[model samples]
Target: MKNLTDKEFEQVIFENQLLILKICSIYCESQADKDDLFQEIMINLWKGLRSYRGESKLSTWIYRVGLNTAISGFKKRKRSPFIQTEELPEHSIDPKLQANQNEEVKILYHAISMLKPIDKAIALLYLEERKYDEIAEIIGISEKNVSVRIVRLKKKLEQIITKQLGG
Candidate 1:
């Protein structure tokens, strides 16, 4: 696209920034690490915007690029132990957040913590309301595998939540 305006670019970032942040939080082991990862994803997004070919939805492209960036960032950070992360930035808790949903969200994070590295990516996409097909494409997995993993993950998440709450 020619003559892309700055406002349009900023709007795209504004709309999807939360999605990137959530993905990093769910995947990274430490708060500082997540923040660093988030920055990397944002930078990659900005850089990749120019290469947009309209082959897929903007969200889909972002998912692919952000995830690739996350994987690479994780690898880089693994090699560098000097980086220290602070507490993760807090999002506003919804005023209407129910007690059960609050507990579930917490336990969900716990479940996410227990997921394997790649599974964390799948879980993040699913949580963001992505279709299995889209997730499969983003992660280079078969659609069937994505479907199967989501089913298994749902059960696994429930078990973790149950165990955490002494159920």
Candidate 2:
């Protein structure tokens, strides 16, 4: 693949910024940490741009880089054992929806935060309505694995949410 010019890189970042932010938010608990992770993902995306072969959809490529960067940064940082019930990064939620569904959204993201790194990635992609094939591609897992994991993740998330709501 040809090198991405500064303009091209900027355009790509602009288009996918929300996706990256979502991944960062899922992997991080605080705005400061999310900002740090977003920068890391951006740097990795810029560095990896030349290596992108267009073998997958551009968004899929972004997801792979974003998730990899988030998970790597997550592993390097220390975290509190308890799940953070704080709101997700502001950019991660729609303000219109937030007005009506704020608490439920918080609970959902809180439940997601309890997931392991790989499982978190799967959950994020799944929730984004990504296809099984695209999710598998981004996750570097087989389609069957993606399907199986989605089933299990649903059950687990439901349990977490139920427990969190004290049901």
The local distance difference test score of each candidate is: 0.79, 0.85
Clashing pairs in 1: 32-85
TM-score of 1: 0.80
Best model number under TM-score: 2
Model 1, 39-128: lDDT tens digits are 778788778788888888888898888888876667776677775554655663333553455776877887998988788888898888
Per-candidate TM vs. native?
0.80, 0.82
Q: Taking the tens digit of each residue's C-alpha lDDT, what string does model 2 give over 1-167?
A: 58878998999899899899889888888676777777779999999999899898889999988988887755564464653434446675465754676776899999998999999999999999999999988888899999999999999999989988889
Could you say which candidate leads in lDDT?
Answer: 2
Tell me the TM-score of model 2: 0.82
Off by over 4 Å in 2: 77-101
